[model samples]
Structures are given as structure tokens and as C-alpha cells.
Target chain A: QQPVQSPQAVILREGEDAVINCSSSKALYSVHWYRQKHGEAPVFLMILLKGGEQKGHEKISASFNEKKQQSSLYLTASQLSYSGTYFCGTEGRGGADGLTFGKGTHLIIQP
Target chain B: NAGVTQTPKFRILKIGQSMTLQCTQDMNHNYMYWYRQDPGMGLKLIYYSVGAGITDKGEVPNGYNVSRSTTEDFPLRLELAAPSQTSVYFCASSGGLAGRNEQYFGPGTRLTVT
Candidate 1:
């Protein structure tokens, strides 16, 4: 099944903050995040492994809560370049190859 | 170096044509996947491979077939294509099922069927 993402769409002013959440019913071994611009391929953001393994790039960070089988992407001090669709891909016990992606959160930043 | 590469960035097929979407990765990754994206449906897994000689069916693999003959190549074949299959297809790869490895993606193939 497809994961659930909150805040289907969000608009923010420059320097503001926004959060995108991805939740799944199955237990996850890792959570993968990606950003996709209009008519472009999705770019890898950061991956959060189980057991408090945290990873981040620039001001974008993600945390995977093993207990809840959920992950959240935190965008701090948003930039215009952050205007895109964010998707979280979940990999679980069956193996990572069978990834189920969320619908994606459309984030728009205004300068 | 190209992490992952896909061919024919855009394609338009008739109702009953066959085509193969090719994908290659230079990173020597063993895991490869094919996904389809519709307007607001995000991405649906079509097929995936664990290694050169092993392939598995994903959620939406009815009209698609995939092969992993070599570690560097995984191609998706569409036989007797239909308009319902028209969507943006993406090819991606990851190292393995270890840790939190991210999957590298190639520029998607936008296919339109009429």
C-alpha cells in the first residue's frame, strides 16, 4: 500500500519553516526522501535508518521513528529552491527493492 | 560518472505497440527498480530486481516485464501497450538492503499512449 503523507500542499514565505510527514503501516528498516521538480526526476535528499541513525543535507533533515513506523522531513528556513514535491520511500523487512512511495507533499516557497 | 541512466526521455506509443525502456547504472549496484507515476498518484512500483539473475514482481506489474541479465542493466519491456499504461516511468537503483542507502534515480521516461 502507498504511504500516507500529511500537508498535501503547503506554501511558505522565504525564511519560513515547513514540515512534511510520511507514515506507513508496515515496519520500516529505513526511510528515503527525495525531491522532484516539475517534469524532472526525483533527487535523493537524505536517508534515515532505524535505531536513531540520522542523516541530513544542507537544511533538510529527516527522522525515522521505528516505534511508530513513520518518518518526517524537516525543512528549516525554507528557500525558493525548496519549492518542489517531497516524497518518502519506505523499505521494510521483505527487502529494500520493493519500495512503496507516498503521494508527496507539494511545497511552494515565495520570495 | 552517470549514476543511473534511462533511454528515450520521451515516447509516444499507439494502443498496441511494444517498447522496451532501458536503464543502466554505472555504480555497479545490485538492486534495480522500475516505477510509474501518474498525475497525483505519486509512484507505483512496477518491478524490481535483486541481482543480475533474479527479478521480482512489485505492486503494479501486470503489463510490464523486467530483466536483470547483467548487474549494470535492467530493462523494462511493455508488450501490447495500452493508454492506461501511459505515465512517467522511472528507473532507480540502490546498493543493497543495508543500512539507509539511498536509491539513485535516472531521468524518467515520459510515455504517452493514444
Candidate 2:
């Protein structure tokens, strides 16, 4: 099943902080975060494996809670360049080689 | 490396027509995938290949077919174009190794069927 992302959309000011959460009903083997700008392909951010520690990219980091089957992307000191749609993808035992992604969280960082 | 590249960045097909979406990666990755994204919707996998000779269906594999005869190429074939097939198609590749599942995506192919 596809994961669910909270706060379908969010607006943030430069230097602000924002959190995008993704939750799944099934147990997760791994969680991946990606960012997509308008008309562009999604770019990989980080991947958190089950029982793995948190991973970060620049000012953005992510956490995976195995017990809750959830993951959250943290964008700190958000920059205007961060304006884009962020997606969280999940893969579990039954998913095999495919990844099911959440609808996505639209983040707008305005000047 | 070119990462991943897809041919025919845009196409419009008439109902019942057939076409192929070509995808190629220069990174020599072991895993390749095809995904379609409707407007404002998350991507849904169409098909994937774990290696040159292995292919598998994904969530939305209907109305589509794929072949992976070589490591550098994975092409998606649309047998009979339908309106429902209109969407942006993306091709991605990954190393499929430990801590290397991060997929590198192509720009994407936008297809419209009417």
C-alpha cells in the first residue's frame, strides 16, 4: 500500500523550518526521501533502512521509526531553493523490488 | 555518465495506436524501473528489471510491456494507447546494492493519448 503524507501542502519563509511526515500501515523495510521541482524528475535525498540511524543531506534530515512504520523529513533553515514537492517512498517485505510512494507534500518556500 | 536518458521527451498518440518509450542509462546500474505520474499524483510503478534478462510487473503494469535485453536499455511498450495512459513517464536506475538503493531518474517522457 502507498504511504500517507501529512499536511498536503505547506508554505514557509526563508530560514524557517518545516516537517513532512509519512506513515504506512504495513511494516517498513526502508524509507526514502526525494524532492521534485516543477517539471523536473524527483531527486533522491536520503534513505533510511530498518534499524538504521538517521540520515541527512545538507540542512535536510530524516528519521525512520520502525515501530510506528513512519518517517519524517526535516527541513531546517529552509531556503527558497527548497520550494518543491517532497515525496516519501516505502518498501517492505511484500513490496519486493518496487517502492510505493506517498502522494507527496508540496512545500513552498517564499522569500 | 549520462545517468538516465529517455527518448521522445513528449508524444501524442491516437487511440488504438502503439508506441515504445525508450529508456537507457549509462551508469551500468543493475535495477531499472518505469513509473507513471498523473497530474498531482504520486508515481506508480509500471514495470521493472532487476537485471538484463529479468523483468517483472509493477503495480500498474496493465496496458504496458517491457523488455530488458541489455543492461543499458529498458524499453516500455504501449500495445494500444488509451486515454488513461496519458501521464508523465519516468525511468530510474539504481545500483540495488546495500545502501545504494537511491535511484537516479531521467527527465521523463510526457505522453498523451486521445
Candidate 3:
């Protein structure tokens, strides 16, 4: 089940804020967030396991809603270095099934 | 220690050619995975292994094959490549622990089949 992400792309200025949302049709056991800079490998940001759980990485944070099968990533006071593509991967009702990711949200932070 | 490493940063192949994408991780993770990313698209799982000698197909495993002979190494093979197989391939590994879902990723291999 490919997760659905909102705001496929967004642009923000330095010290700005943004949110990227991901939802899935099926139930999600866990949600993983990662960021990929241009020409670089994707770096893990954080993971939300239980419903209503939240995790953070520096100025970024994420929340998972088990009932809605949705996850949201919040970027606070964005910086130019924050410019990258953000991906939300969901491990849905898993046994042996691997993580399925959304299309991704391209974030651009301008100075 | 190198988290995860993939060889052949980039490659161009002719149709019907065969090649292997090498992946090795030093973290001694229990789970390893292979994925491909298309232009402006999310990464799609190609194959995954929970342990050595145990591999399973992913969502898109049509033209690719994988083998895990050791804990630290997972290799993906392309047999008779097709133009549709051209994509950026990534290798990843993770511990089975709940909090360790954050998989370590390697710089992907960009493969183009003509």
C-alpha cells in the first residue's frame, strides 16, 4: 500500500515552518521519516511506532495517528540547509512485507 | 564503520546484459533490503532478507534477483536487463529492534539499461 503524501512540494524561507503529511489506506504499524539532499543518500530522521506517539530530530518532529493511519512531519524554524526531499515510509500491518513509501515532499528553504 | 556501502556508483548496460549490485554493511544488522527509485518517485522495495540465506520478493522484483550469503552482505543481480529496469538502486540495512526501523542507507547505484 503506497502511502499518500500531501503538498507534494513546498517552499519556505529561513526561520519558516512547514508540514508534510502522509496517509495510508490500510492500517499502519509504524511510520518512518527520511530526508535526502541533492546527490546524497537518504538520511533517517525519526520513527513513530505507537499511535499518538511523537518523535523529534533537532528542529524536526513527527506524529503518527493510528486510527487515521496517518503521519505528519513538522519542520520548525527551517534553515537553508533544510532544503531537501522528505519521504514518509509506512510499514503497514507487517509480517514480512517491507516498508512502502509515499511519493515524497520536495522542500526548499530559501534564504 | 561504514554503515552501508554500494558499489558501481553508476553504470550503463546494454539490453540482455547481466550485472550484480554489491551491498555490504558493517553494522551487523539482521535485516537487509534492496530498493529502486525512479525519477521523482518514491523508493520501491525490490527484495529483502531477514537473515543470511533468507530472501523474499518485494513489490517490484520482476527483473531483479537477490542473494544473502552473509550477515553483512546482500547482493542484487540483474539477469537480462531491460530498459524498464533502469533506475537508481539503493541498499539498506536495519536491526530488528522496534526502535531501529531507521534503516541505514548507502549511496545508491544509478543503472541505465539501453
Q: Candidate 3, after superposition: displacement of residue A55 in Å? A: 5.4
How well does each candidate superpose onto the true structure, as a TM-score? 0.95, 0.96, 0.95
Model 2 regions lying over 4 Å from their true place: A54-58, A92-96, B97-100
List the candidates ranked by DockQ, beginning with the highest: 1, 3, 2
| Candidates in descending lDDT order | 2, 1, 3
Q: Report the number of the highest-TM-score candidate.
A: 2
Among all candidates shown, the one with the greatest DockQ? 1
Q: Candidate 1 on B17-89: residue-level lDDT in tens?
A: 9999999999999888899999987888889888999998888999899889999999999999999999999
Please give the distance, in angstroms, between residue A42's alpha carbon in candidate 2 and its true position after superposition.
0.4
Cα displacement (angstroms), candidate 3, residue A89, comes to 0.4
Candidate 2 residue-wise lDDT, B4-113, digit = tens: 99999999999999999999999989889999999888999899888999998888999999999999999999998999999999999988731337888999999999
Highest lDDT scorer: 2
What would the per-residue lDDT of candidate 2 be over residues A14-109, giving only the tens digit for each residue? Answer: 999999999999888888899999999999898888878545465568888999998888889999999999999986335446678889999999
Q: Kindly indicate the candidate among 1 and 3 with the higher DockQ.
A: 1
Name the runs in model 3 displaced over 4 angstroms.
A52-58, A92-96, B97-100
lDDT of 3 by residue, B18-107 (tens): 999999999988888898999899999999989999998889999889989999999999999999999999998888732336778999
C-alpha local distance difference test of each model: 0.87, 0.88, 0.87
Query: Model 3's DockQ?
Result: 0.57
- Least well predicted 10-residue stretch by lDDT in candidate 3 chain B: B94-103
